[model samples]
Target: MPRTDTASRVITAPLDRVWDALVDPAALAVWLPPAGMTGRFERFDARPGGSYRLVLTYADASGAPGKATADSDIVEARFVDIVPGVRVVQAVDFVSDDPANAGTMTMTWQVTAVAAGTRVDIVATDVPDGITAEDHAEGLASSLANLAAHTER
Candidate 1:
């Protein structure tokens, strides 16, 4: 069965700023990768029906092997929906030879104005079985923290 994982954070920034950080490719390259990893986008088209290819490389090569390469995880994602300042939805897949990791995951990012700042929520559904629950949770938390740090500045 597929799994779902979620993470959320409140950023000390306005809704627009937070939303910008989410859609801008440069900002995403800076904040999307989890701890111990760094990401770069080969192609990015931020619009509904558009797509992107991102490569995330592990800082320590000796760590667990990546899904696509020895040190990198390549992700192909399509923009399913984009609601400026409100939400962004994506269909994502990893480039991997392992059958357990072959699946499309839906990622939804929602932002709302709150008392102190903007609240960002991330929901990832249909997660592949190859990604363990604990690891996914940690990665999601790490990415959320990164986004908060990047946007709150």
Candidate 2:
């Protein structure tokens, strides 16, 4: 069975700024991690049928210095729906090198504009067997915080 996890956060920034930070590679690298972590996008295409790949490096939760990795090279991302500055729905699939979990998964990012800022919701389904929902939740929260900071600045 495929497990699903959802995470959300509200940022005090304009919708356009939030959207730009989400799609731009350079801007994404700046706000995609916690204080001690950093990320870089290898390939990113904002439109549908495009591919997206990013590398995230961070110290373990125990404060130990180590590299954490996540890759999605075979992603067939498509913009399912868009409402200009209001909202966006995207479908993402993961490609893994491990033979044990070679299947693809789908993730949806839903953004809503609010009076104070923007509300972002991410629902990822079909997570591989070894990955835990709690860990993914923590990571998504950290990334959203970083994103909020980046957009505010």
Q: Highest TM-score, which number? A: 1
- In the range 1-153, model 1's lDDT, one tens digit per residue, is 999999888888999988998899999999999999999999999999999999999998686789999999999999999999899999999999998889999999999999999998989999999999999999999998999888887
Task: Report every candidate's CA lDDT.
Answer: 0.94, 0.66
For residues 88-147, write the lDDT of model 2, one tens digit per residue: 566654445554344455667667889988898878777666455776688788888888
**Candidates' RMSD to native:** 0.7, 4.0
TM-score of candidate 1 to 2 decimals: 0.98
Off by over 4 Å in 2: 34-36, 60-101
Residue 119, model 1: Cα distance from true site in angstroms: 0.8
lDDT of 2: 0.66
User: Residue 40 in model 2: shift from native, Å?
Assistant: 1.5
